[model samples]
Target: MTHETTRIHPAALMYAEEEKAGKLSRREFLARTTALGVTAATAYGLIGAAQPAQAGGHAQQGGTIRMQMEVRALKDPRTFDWPQIAYFAHGWLEYLIEYNNDGSFAPMLLSSWDVNDDATVYTLNVRPGVTWNDGTPFTAADVARNIEGWCDRNVEGNSMAGRFAVLIDDATGTAIEGGIEIVDDLTVRLNLPASDISLIAGMSDYPAAVTPANFDPENMLGNPVGTGPYLPEGLEVGVRATLVRNEGHDWWGYAEGKGAFLDRIEYIDYGTDPSAWVAAAAADEVDMFYETTGEFIEIIEGIGWERTEIASGASIVIRPNQLAEVDGMTPYADKRVRQAIAMAIDNNVVLELGYNDRGEVARNQHVGPMHPAWADVPRIEYNPARALELLTEAGMADFEMDIVSIDDDWRKNTTDAVAAQLRDAGFNVKRTIIPGSTFWNDWTKYPFSSTDWNHRPLDTQILGLAYRSGEAWNESGFANAEFDALLAQANAIADADARREVMAELQQIMTDEGVTIQPYWRSLYRHAKPGFVGWDMHIAYLPQMYKVGLAA
Candidate 1:
């Protein structure tokens, strides 16, 4: 059945009225409609009705939006539940004080904040009246508690603890002493030993979402409470998570004049394939889906559903474990050999097959043009001839390597393409595709493997996480004293120009040294039936339900 033929629920009808009245922008209209009880599919259809200019000129209210996901059991935002599969949980369950969009920090849970002299002190004013899912008031105490939990070695919150530890150490120039201090009931202050300009920017990630004092670390799957606009009403492991409106939450970042309208949101987890989720959306069985693939872009565009396409400002890279050793072998030990391997993969082909011409070729650098750090940095182009030369010069002319990747169809396709390109570049490349469940746990243990690294903060956070030794996600086992020193220097540099220069140098090192090879940047797209509204693309790539509603 065509998306247009799908019946628009009454909630969607309410949103449609607002659209016709030209009361809101396309994005605002979409956000309002989704909150009013419009299905995601129907919302997509409504968005597709007119160009962004004409379609976004309305305001709507009241709707239940249903979204789809491939795979399940990723309800917890904390811990290493599923590193690559927790976007849904992050979006629905947590609220970061600040957030980055197109590389700019915007306020979220915090009403306002300021960094002190040389980035050594940060004071944040928490928004009052915000409440957790359980109706507990959100306050500065919650923020302090969450930070302590993440940095506590005993808690082992997640892979991010190590990263936070680095920042804390840098700030205090000591072990994470008593750095977090509560200034007042709605204000918190952080004192660091050294300058850390990027610390505030990095802290604005979903993983840093505040947790209440009574929250249990072990049993967090069922009971999670945050200041977000939605609360988990039903949860079935390996199945789905149902969310209802957070009645006490009327403080969404975009809820200026109007408030959230919908009363419910249901996230259905299916298989890990885009096709499976697409089938569900097309059948009207699911409202929306996460992680759309390039192969399905064309199909979705012409399927008669309203669609919203936005740049996700993120890239997918295959991070090789630098720490893992096999049979006393360190294959990635030689930096030149790693560089050769990076040069061998043809990113252009991967972008075509995997991204469907929707994204730009990835430079080996972690930061993209969307980031302020990207300036005059040359893009890395595919050159198999040069790759062969590098491999030969490294004295590994006949090198044969096996690349490990998850068994998901998209990842399989990407790995196969890389293997073929490496073969053409005069290296023997074998692809090992394993099940998604097993791959997450075992791939990091493998000395040489290719795993996806998804959405992250800015260049500072990305570099700190991957390049800093002992970092939780530093599976690459990459360690350079010079890089570490430079990162430390950049963290303290308060001058924007100086910081940018330091960041540029870091990006150059990643590209020249080939710590990790980036193939392409990914864009986020959604498909829905017409008459739904109110879904805006954020840097984290998860749709915020409270900002959406249906037309009347």
Candidate 2:
């Protein structure tokens, strides 16, 4: 496919022309005019037109596909179950909504939805005729129950608690408020604290899964109930999750006349070692393997496996905890120290080892240029000499610090390279490999260490979780009142153009302050047997099982 230059909107061009004649840029002009956040014109322009699929071919049904995942658990969508396990269960469970292929918001369980003028109230229209695996009617009560579970402090239902807190009015910035209301049997309404357009889009695209109201969180071990086209057949925690077609599901709007084409989907979790999973796919032991690291792409393809390359939705960054002050001093508090660390590491070397030449180096401030509000930030090239100079100037040359990573070969290699680079830059570096289970647990407790974070939903989400005050994931303890204010303003702004300007400003602040040292973005490669087809590669690191089928 040929790459196209992003088309700036006509209004944007007019604004640019006006700016050239002694006014600010069109973006600035529009931001002033609407008094809203950055306008969506630029983002809308950046999004490429949907490409037409090849014609003359029809989809075939019927298949039982076996897949390998790194891990699994009891099929509970509402609980703090593993993501891989949730992805496997999502196939069997129906969601209240579903995302379209083009990333547009669409109705699945809900036939339609209405938003008030202020964008604070959202009324969802639930579809009728959907039944759970046990032949129970799916209703809005189920949606309300799921939302209540997420907002419940005692339940701790996965990351949704924090995420939902950001969306609800009473629930915003707090875990106690219940913002979801059940409006009769087929209708549900959500009242937000602020007007956020992105929330609606995110609800339709990501986080659309809705579990049954009757499914008990504490007692529903190894079993889940949903109105999805598939139902769980068997489940073994940390081992495998299997699903079979529900046959009773008829509510999905996106599927229309097409039901789940597969009869069964078996997700076999293989842990951090994707190499073993790749071997399984090559040996035909598994029909497909997901989130395959770039290093295994060649090996899988070399063995007659076909694969799909999806954009790595997330970037890998080294975060230094600023709250863990040593002798009344935060090492990362000094801008010079952070810059020095950023300049010391060689991203190309890490990419070579981790991605095997398939991934691209990230120089932009945001995760990708596709994000509407993204801006070009100053780049810090790899220069160990400069790094040492900065470290010395900051009087941190003798400072010893721990770079933490999970006890996995890939993470070990990454931290090792970072240690060597920092050492070469004249800083005392100690590499620590914490067990994977304990790493996540301790890292969140704000241990005095640096570690890697996975894919975050959006720039704002990451900012709120990592930089905002009192956030669970705020290990860095980096706080800026100005940054927080700007984020709040951006969240309420309705105009896309105005929002972009604020977002750009936010990115600039993070980069200039050296909040985190983002080096390389990670990519995913999926290897599947030629017989398998229709599986959607999700950027959220979750794979869709109901979409897959065997090509007879």
Candidate 3:
């Protein structure tokens, strides 16, 4: 038979797709598996991947996908720290762009957008007929409110402020750092103060959900409405949340098998116990859990639930209290002392004890290998001798310190290990493990704290938001003009390769002088029941609930 060289394998593409949808019998499935030269165990899938749902609009008359989450949930979208709020935000608020199922990003509320020469300006065209649950029109005003709320440091707990800082100015809530020219209800021209190529990614940044112009905190706690396909039916803090499908609206997700697959979603807050959550998953009481620690993996797998080891962007860093005198951690301010603490804590040991060696030891930089801008920087090794030398060199051989962390098992255990290592290096160490809620109440104000941060797709966005000089979320109190200049240069360059070179420089400088001691990265694990179909994992470390469905 004549064949086209570029054509795909018939058995590999169309043939398997037809049979994999559960359209073929067991015999057929086995035949196809054998023909494809694959193991049936890997190909057939546990819940039967062959039975994926066909798609249309959000008009499906469906069922519920119940989930149990860890304690300490996010009450507000704009003030979210933990990613649990992403499930609620995705229900209502819409982003200008969305990370799609195929590992690519596409426009959501924004039909499309364009950038000017220096990337200082972006013309965003909003989607038509999208409205809030209250029926108020979603316009440029709502976008302005959400972005401004993100930039306002006074607005409760907004971690995204630093990312939006350079792109906008305060003119009746929003002046386009240079100027915001509203062309129409659906279109606006954003003029930025500095050249920033990552502005669009920043637009889709977490807590970037579009909200009404009249945003209220109290209402947000109960149910701050947005333009999602589901409505918050009820929410009780750290207890339970009930969300129902909005029959009036359309879920804007694209591609095949895309739509509102669930009629409702109930988030059952299982408190802070991982074992309870794991038990619930084993008994099939809960449909999913975003994270399952290494200890419970065997139990969960034994229960026959589907498992996915996602290549997530999360790094665990030990940050020193640079501007606080509250703890005896004041010694962390000295560069040599900070370097000593960084060298003393062996990351591999922490990972082995805390994560069951699930992750790799990190380098001096925050950007992990999963990120696009990642450059292999120098790895700071575990060196007790070097740490003792540095402590003596800094004249702090007799120094004592207090390290604070979330009292949760993962963080507390890891910090305990780190504290022991530091004590061995001739430093007196005190460990104060507080509850997650209490620890985060004054999170950045903490001294000698170990923190776990989610991933941002671009390295520049993370650097700009969390490590930028004087930025709101700069946990390390890191401030360096040279680093800022290099970051700015990278943001403005627009060329991919050149920006990467600048990013490499930023990583090196932070390692040499940065305040945070990041020893390792954490692997992300998601456990789903056999009933879930079309659920995808986001490397950005947030849930994509709306794209998933309860099995029929």
Candidate 4:
């Protein structure tokens, strides 16, 4: 043993004690101790043979990391609408590509891709020598199957299916044979019905992780399986999910020596208890907590933890289902009623009261002002009198409706503000603050709720997912043949200026016809312990956990 083998990390020393207490397996302890430059005999006084040195020397590994989130259930990667499920999936599942914070494309499982001049045909080439978590070789067939899996309605990944709609004839959910063709062992081609520039944006979409087509729902939603850097070995729905680094996993785009830096990462759901999370993080019981809302900014900063502030082009909107009806007509389905709600609330008030003025008030567009394609559409002026006039004109002077949201402090306050404004506009509104789990998990059950969306590198990414007619995440139940035509038109434009122009027209068209009130955009943030390193906020607002490591 060398001189460096004599020294042990304080965390590793504690982990060794936990191993001795039977809290950790011998293999785990050995991997961790060896990562700290200690052999088994040197680490735990064992009689085993000496082990070889680890590959890298910068970050000390082997500690079991505990992180906090607001997840209710860890199952069903297809329904990963919130941060909880997606965060864990980030470790165990790999996306085809990722969007950088600067709105540039970064290759992941797919090394490179090419598009035809018309953007109708896309050819994808996967990275060489990659294998799934189960040790199966990753190939073009896997990508093709995974693409088909997304289009399968039973898989319930239709939100992602919306992005890959070129593969399916929307009118009949039938696969267009040439739409997604496996060209070779490591190559696939996408022959779309029409030109769509948004195809590149789908590479980074959630549930973009490639999987074997034969992977049933049990393996997909219950015990997770993928070609990611890590694997959630024994994932249970409501309880904590334990992710172990796949030591033999040959991930294509691993930046660090072995990709996942930590040996074990545990996701602990704190539900709606922010104080419990803060206390755990402050005491080093947890290394990270997701989405530290602006209301808790002062408290997190006071705890002296490092926090990230990414201008999340994320929008907060009151989404009306537009499906509940009255005399064969959904009230919110009326453009005038939707416009009335937009004119009722002062978005700045909600920002100040609920968000602590930490975000930019949204324009009529769903896109952030930071994006190059942003177009400042006319916002319905904040006039409660005008809102009343519009409602009265629609013969709904004192209409009654229930508004729903999460029970969290931030959402509660925001919903309260929104409800008060809507009430003032001669609408009878009852607010229902459901649990965080129910709010996002059972989103389809409710007709109206204030929704929080994450940032997308391109507006078309979110548009294709949330705004398009028949999109799986179309919670607003909004549909318009004209809007659909303009959406395709926007995505078909290859020229930047022409795309922006079309995007502007789409923005105005949606504001004048859709069932939503874009109040403001949130400033997304995440807090980490002092010992954490290499963490970055992706454009998707999902933290990049692949590069995280404990400082040496």
Candidate 5:
């Protein structure tokens, strides 16, 4: 029963030992190992656990796995407005890496990668013999093009610009001239200006889907060129999307007996109502859910379908826009006002009212316990009396504030709970609920709003996206030179223990500044019928349909 443990990374081996010591869950152990380039089968072998039924050519390859999710419009991969759009487009578009359910990563378009000791340079080894559905050879140039597009802030609605900022010059919004180097047909090198340990993890993000060097946004739907296994057959926005397997070409992973197991994949829009999905699941109309909220978990379970859960950093941030103004005054610009808003509401109450208490109460800091670089920082106590004092000191005691949120059940409930708490604290509060279609249009521009941020493997990744000055997705308009500097210092340190020391300071700064009231770290769930293999709940809500199929 000897496993192939010799080639496992030292860090992954350490994680295995920790698992043996009862310090890590099996899922967590596999996640760390797969992220470090060890295959899932090998990691399972090391623990003497049976591999998934689909692994090693045991997969049933011809059934469909229909999921209940919104089918949003498809456009440039970098400008995907919502995660559902990314999840839908992911059927045809693939990333360089796959972030697993347990916060680990798996190689996708790129075979493997190596990062320097200081995390300044990343040598990406592109998977050879891979080709687009149209038979175009996939190469390092395609990878370079995708990276360049992500680093370009000039592209309107390019959400990836913030995460790719590490490779760009501050003066120029575009990537540095020599930041991406094509070493050969199969190798690509990244020369980062600063050390960023999250760069590789960032690639697995939904928006980082790689496209051909000459990809055209206008013809995206007509001729979607990707290295994935599925091709768009039908896409009726807000209704349904049908993706059929690329029978014309063999997927790159087929030889490895990994993903591309399902013959057809379907995404049906059940709207924002969980009740609609509950009924649909009961009727056997949908095989699984894009995500199962706490309110419907019991109903879905009563249907006898199995569920997978993962503790993730996915959470909502209710905060005021520091850069926006109201009545010729920027009330939230004062840190005291933001701090007062955070202090007025109890996160535990919000969790109970909004999520049915399905998650852990989160401090104002964005970092979560699941992240490798997480540090235990101070917690902000719920103190309405102190909150009122801070509000009076900031000259906002009577200033009315508006809270905006999407019209979905969980989000609206969460925002309503916060607004009620704020009103109870003697502050004037207003609530606005808008449709999902229109809400994301001006999401970042809202004076005060709640935004659901997806999970990133490292805390630094999410910080760069949401808090970094002038980044495209900096919804809170939070900017501090000192905090940014500390983040840079933390990103450069690759060792988790070393990075954690810096993370402690970063977490303190985030809480002290009151950037956002991050109420809870969500526990993501998904339910699938019996006999389905390889379909697991992803922490980030990424739809990894290529790996899913029913048993033979």
Candidate 6:
């Protein structure tokens, strides 16, 4: 064995001890350990070969679990803009891997996977005998089709296109002819243009759910056929969505005697108001809620429900559309204008006033402390007077800019705080608060707006998916050749310490160019009843409902 495999990570050692003490589940132990670079087999050996199922022997089955959350539209999985869409779709649609809140990854649709030493080639072993709800066999071809969909830049707003860009020709906007190969009925191979450690992690993203070869993007709700244990029983868009157990269906996981504990799953719409959810929890109208923030965290906890918290890199970005124009001038197109806006507001105030000190102040860079590549760079000092000087220097001192935001509690508060700061700096600003139902309709087209970005395992993952030039999710229209090249270099280096050196350069470029004002890194929270089992707060706000059960 290599010296690396023999050495136990400090965090992994603690997790193994916790597993032995009965304070952590075997699944959680493996998740935390493997996330720290520990091999799965080694981790299992540490905790003993014979172990009980994660659900526990005393786990009760066949019960309903209701949650107060938004039920958004679902179309092509590649274009999902929010985690809720993926969370809801997961009831029926399954991802190739499960990226846990603790930074560990668990195998899902794929029984196992192997990556070459250079990380350029990935071999995926699909779980055999898995059947879609429509009785179609799920094989390697289906996985290849989903990968093809991710690499196709032709699909507008396909965020996965950027994440899987290595598999496609950037000039032609099409997947490279032989990038994906079906090695066998259960094996699929990925030949990437370059080394990328984020491939498996990308597959775990909400938008990367595997679909059938002939799956129709225009009609997902109509054809919600998947190998998951639950079936979509009802869907009412903004109202509510329900899933019932696929009775008598021989689920692939059942043979291992794991998961599929709940008979029914429901996601009821409670709008963007946290108080509405608090009221529901008080009256016992819901079993759990999607996420709790600000004042709602304590309120939900005081109701006798257990709170699960995760330190996440999730944050909100208040960015400008560098491509859009206002009053015959593209103000954000000027570097000074973007920089001035970035310097005007204080992220500390956003965290305190908007989030009620629920998170850590950000340094205007997308990378957060939780990310492996996060660098402690010099902070961009907040100086409104200096911001005004830059605005005047750019000949846009009085340019009227619009700040659009959703009417959600924390997001709107955060936007309001930014608008107030910009106004104090003598900039002309207009605030447009849209309903949650309409906010995402044309979210990326706004001249200036706030977008909630979820957490990724690697900082380079989000950089490729959202900031790279020509990426579908490049909401700020940020295209920098230097930034993209440096990103590729970072992805190629497998060592975290070495990759972090390149990330420092990336963070500097992102800040120097005034890409986006990322205020704070969120501390995510979720609440469930005392007897609730299996469900935990995910850093990305995902729900693995199949393993979620109620304790009797």
| lDDT: worst 10-residue window of model 1 | 50-59
Superposition TM-score, candidate 3 onto the true structure: 0.83
TM-score of 4: 0.84
- Encode model 4's per-residue lDDT on 256-337: one tens digit a residue: 3544668888877777757777777777777787668755777877878888767677777777778766456677877788
What tens digits encode model 5's per-residue C-alpha lDDT throughout 58-103?
Answer: 4676878798997788889898757788777787788988777644
* Candidate 3 residue pairs in backbone clash: 20-50, 21-50, 22-50, 169-177
Q: Could you give me the TM-score of model 1 versus the true structure?
A: 0.80
Report the Cα lDDT for residue 491, model 6: 86
- List, residue by residue over 228-253, the lDDT tens digit for candidate 2: 67667767766777777766655353
- Which parts of model 4 are misplaced by more than 4 Å? 1-58, 72-76, 153-157, 221-224, 248-258, 326-329
On a 0 to 100 scale, what is the lDDT of residue 184 in model 3? 85
Q: lDDT per residue, candidate 6, 1-552, as tens digits?
A: 111336666656666777799766555566545644455667777877653346434558888989988998778888888888877787778887877654567677877776666778887888778888778898998888888888888988888887777788878887887899999999998898888877777888888888876778677767777888877888899999898888856788788676788889999998998998888888888999898888888887787889988877899999998988777777799999999999899899888888898889998889876666678886567899999999999998877888999998999999999999999889999999999999999888789999999888777888897789978788898999999999989988765557889999999999899999999999988899888787778878766777788786
Model 6: how far residue 504 lies from native, Å: 1.1
The C-alpha stretches of model 3 lying farther than 4 A from their native spots are: 1-61, 71-76, 101-103, 153-156, 169-178, 221-223, 248-257, 327-329
Shift in Å, residue 13, candidate 2: 17
lDDT scores in order: 0.61, 0.59, 0.67, 0.69, 0.82, 0.82
lDDT of 5: 0.82
TM-score-better candidate, 4 vs 6: 6
Runs of candidate 2 with Cα error greater than 4 angstroms are 1-60, 74-82, 116-118, 152-158, 166-181, 204-208, 247-255, 324-336, 346-349, 363-366, 379-386, 389-395, 407-412, 434-459
Candidates 4 and 5 compared by lDDT, better number: 5
lDDT of 1 at 344: 77
- Model 4: C-alpha RMSD to truth? 13.6
Error of 1 at 459 (Å): 2.3
Of candidate 4, the 10-residue stretch with the lowest lDDT total is: 1-10
Q: Provide TM-scores for the models.
A: 0.80, 0.79, 0.83, 0.84, 0.92, 0.91
- Candidate 1, number of clashes: 50
